[model samples]
Target chain A: MREVAALAGVSVKTVSRVVNQEAGVSSAVRERVSSAVSRLDYRPNLAASNLRRAGARTGLIGALVQDLSNSFSAGVLRALEDTARAHRTGVLATSLDEGVERERELVHDLVTRRVDGLVIMPASTRHDYLVSELRTGTPAVFVDRPPRGVDADSVVVDNASGARSGTEHLLARGHRRIAGLFHLTQIVTVQHRIDGFRSAHEAFGLVPDPRLVVTDISSAEEATRVVDRLLALDDPPTAIFAARNLLATGAVRSLAQHGLRRSVALVGFDDFPLADLLDPPLTVVRQDVARIGRTVGELIFQRIDGDTSPPRHVVIEPTLVVRGSGEIRPTA
Target chain B: MREVAALAGVSVKTVSRVVNQEAGVSSAVRERVSSAVSRLDYRPNLAASNLRRAGARTGLIGALVQDLSNSFSAGVLRALEDTARAHRTGVLATSLDEGVERERELVHDLVTRRVDGLVIMPASTRHDYLVSELRTGTPAVFVDRPPRGVDADSVVVDNASGARSGTEHLLARGHRRIAGLFHLTQIVTVQHRIDGFRSAHEAFGLVPDPRLVVTDISSAEEATRVVDRLLALDDPPTAIFAARNLLATGAVRSLAQHGLRRSVALVGFDDFPLADLLDPPLTVVRQDVARIGRTVGELIFQRIDGDTSPPRHVVIEPTLVVRGSGEIRPTA
Candidate 1:
């Protein structure tokens, strides 16, 4: 800092102000400080600067996950841990269980601890408070789903494309009556997947039959009931496409109970543990969770580094991994 | 603090000195400060005290996990996350991959971040550096396995008891020959389970028969080969105990492939997803992962509270969850 100040022909306080990006510094002084900083290869001692204030870096990055029990969330969290470790920062992980008050409390506590940044999966529809917090120079990025009612960096799966491709694969295999099972979460990601599924059905010149669609089943058990009803239909679908792993588990169980594994072709979104090891291996669209997490971590770090141009959202596409279930020729 | 000093009939500096437990303070003065603290319900804010110094709560806890992919670590990490969230603290998690340099770097990074406490599942044979760090008033506790060459609070499962119970259950079902399949982690927990299995066989006046024991198999594929070799033997064991979930997966696959699911009995140490829905439900010795995690969290928090008492070790007992697979009565 002293070398920069000397080279810039300015007082130490002026150089400090310029480096910290304080508003009072004149444009000319800022330019001089920037040039001098470049010339000296001066890297500001961030820890020292933070120590001058009560709120220090805590060297922690707060990660607010939606649910820990979900395999997707766990995988993403692990990836984030790896990224944070590389930056010499540690993660402070909290699960909100989709509660608004819990999210608020978590955010406030993390702020009080002065974490370096946050990677949050917001559950609530109203994210204006988060927007305000971001506007005040706090770096944050949303994952799994985009931030609603706010502008920020986001990392999400190309759910619509994934669903379309999955449904199209079923259609290409001569299956017209395909049931789509999904959870009732009001997140934009789920909406995109549903839209994609609809698009694929329309492309095949088929109506999006309401009877073949199931929603509002919050758990695998309820999903099992939905599957039971679908298979019990007079013209039961020749195939099923579960929109998530838990629903897929339910579908698999339903098929196994009725000994229909040899008849119905099953395709699921999101690959899960033991998916391939099943009696008739499951075919599903697998998301690159680790890559998505790593991308979000990098974006958040860039955002924190004053890379403030515009909010960016990156969507990685999912790939279909065919094992056996999806490749089954429907014997309808 | 001023009020406390007044109530204790001491100067504010004297109160501070007593609170910090500086050696210069007299016992009488310490007693007075203690009484004043109790009366005022005053909790000294370490953050405030460390304004010009280094030690402070940092409001962060570090968790060092051996392998995130392992079910045991995942369960414990989830439980620790829940407990840490309730305490309004954040947990920084990292996977060691059992690398000594990685562990050292992780420990250094966590200490540099000034985390209030640590919950570690050691990766190396010894971590004396961690011991030195803890000795400087940094609180730490071990989980799954204790740190080598140091004494500290540790929380682990009763591996021996669980293994012994499982082995005895198999013996009681009139199975004369039993095989043990273990992973290649070379961890103490694994050794304990092997010992317990041996003890059970010895109690029944049966030899362990080296041919029946298979080691150095970590993944499902490797375990499948080991199980195949055991099953191919002229005098194959009537039953097997897989030491972990992946091994259990292998055992299930091998048993199913050989059409031996109904004839051969098997019990696994850790539970896997969808174990109950297999051809025959798997029996497992289930560890209380959540309980063990909560215990470790509490121990670390207590240490962070400046409890300089002797180190304590906690062992949580495992339960035998009997299912269809282990109850297959061997026929003569």
Candidate 2:
């Protein structure tokens, strides 16, 4: 700690504050201390002490997600919470809302507050900033998306396969004008889904019309607006593939508004709670949320239990939930 | 700290461990130390130190709710998170899952970890257990329901009034036989909603059919089963009042399955995302979740800012969101 302080030109207490995740330290000082620590390969003694307390843990884990209210994130969180509770641990859950700065700040807060581990749904494009915290032996399991610029344990569904299957389903239904609705982020999962969308078209010797694919939606409300615009086009899409749950819901609304729900087919990526109860019962590429969450919980706890193994990446396959909405044949 | 250790017949480090929320202390030791703490009214010096760091405070707050996966709870959590982030505070969120023991334990964990404050949607019947934490200068504000067996700041929507309005809407729709689908728990919020259901019937000089009011539903799936049974009854209800969001969704499913959605009127208690996009567009009693969450956030932050004022209770009234489903005319 003293060496890190000297190297960073800060007091020993400042280094301790940075390492412990306490507030009051300026971002610049935190950066300097973190750089110095990384340069010196400093691992906090506290993490070493944590490894020794095999049976006893802080009884708390942090769950950082894009949005806790979203069905996909919520389902994963519930599964993790149930697993943590069985072990008498409480989750310190927070939503990042896709803000890069917010994710960094909250991660710092959760660590400073001293959680046993973390299950992160990273919003930040890169996670190398967390290298110091990870090296200090804080077990982190990324969920829904793989970690960027830093290696860690992660649990994600096969986004590409899921998207391919949904698109294939639409193609099999003989829908030629299939529109792809996707979120705006450059997130790997979203990109993979878009790739799947295009690849499905290519495999069948059909080129996807760039105009039919709408991307860069920020919210479900935005999805509705984008879907409305797509429907307004002279050559409207006969089938729609929504890459996210909220986007799917938005497509449903737009289709309903345009009186096209029964005429145009739709497929969603993630299945939500009442998707089956929708007007036409939404067809979705369902990621086994409970299993994904369980995988994440297992990996995080395994590391907490002193596992020094190399980081593991688990990708669960997505299954197609064939409900009525996606089964709608494109009308002539 | 010395006195607490002495009184509890534990070492000072054990007491420190308990106070600092560190692991390694057994539950028995924790209980004894907590008891000693309560008996001696011991306030950890850390909390005092927290007060001195007023401007540079702990950028963490605890948010305890029933289930973060539930739409209502998730919405509340999101609202609180938005507000907290605006103030540079991170939420240490958790799900209580309707377990009293779990709520107590999680609360203990959050308090001992020294969050700036808390916003709780409590599962515990009584919150007198939290008197010590509150007394120790941790600001707490309850949401969705008022604290029982204790006086504290609270922000709750008038559940009874909202439910009554929904029931009355159905009554005014010329429905004589109305079924009430309710959740099992004796949660005050649920009870208030039930009371509203009954009072609405009484106002019209009618006796509610006990057989039609099916309660004890534990899950959204259970809500489906209960609604199915209600429909199976001889002279089934002409309309249904679902006292919760999940129950409402279940009721919609049941109605859809029975091919009676257009004929049977239904009104749900709490509004959920995409409620307006349902087949007939569900009419619901809207709780103004954003307002409620914002109010809770404001109160807790005020208390954290060293407001030693008397506890305040804020009750927001709910409004009926009338859509197609709830406005259905009874099939005579």
Best of the candidates, lDDT: 2
B1-332 per-residue lDDT for model 1 (tens digits): 89899999999899888877888988988999989976775545434555546554566788889766466787788888887866767788888877778888877667655677888898776767666566545678889876678778889888899899999999989998888998664678888899889899988998788899887787888888888989999888889999888898898888878989889999999875666656567889998887887888788877877788999988888999998789888856
TM-scores for every predicted model: 0.78, 0.82
Q: Which ten residues in a row have the lowest lDDT in candidate 1 chain A?
A: A41-50
lDDT per residue for candidate 1 within A1-332, as digits (tens), equals 89999999999889888877889887988999999987775655445566576545546788888776577777787788888877777777777777889887777666545677889987776688675455435688988778878888889888999999998999899998899998765766777878988999999888767899877666778878888999999999899989988888888888888888868998999986768667677899999888978898899778766698888988888999998888778775
lDDT of 2 at B66: 80
Indicate the worst ten consecutive residues by lDDT in candidate 2 chain A: A43-52
Off by over 4 Å in 2: A1-57, B1-58
Q: Over the stretch B1-332, how does candidate 2's per-residue lDDT look in tens digits?
A: 79999999999889878987998889999999999976775544422335444454656798998888888888888888788878877777788778889788777767656678988899877898887666546788999989987778999999888989999999998999999988865788888888899999999998899998877776777887788888888898889999989889988888888988888888998898778878789999999888888888888888888898999999999999988898888887
Query: Whole-model lDDT for model 2 versus the true structure?
Result: 0.84
Docking class of 1: incorrect
Restricting to chain A, the TM-score for each candidate equals 0.82, 0.83
Which parts of model 1 have CA positions greater than 4 angstroms off?
A1-49, A53-58, A172-177, A228-238, A257-263, A304-306, A327-332, B1-56, B127-129, B172-177, B228-238, B250-265, B302-311, B327-332
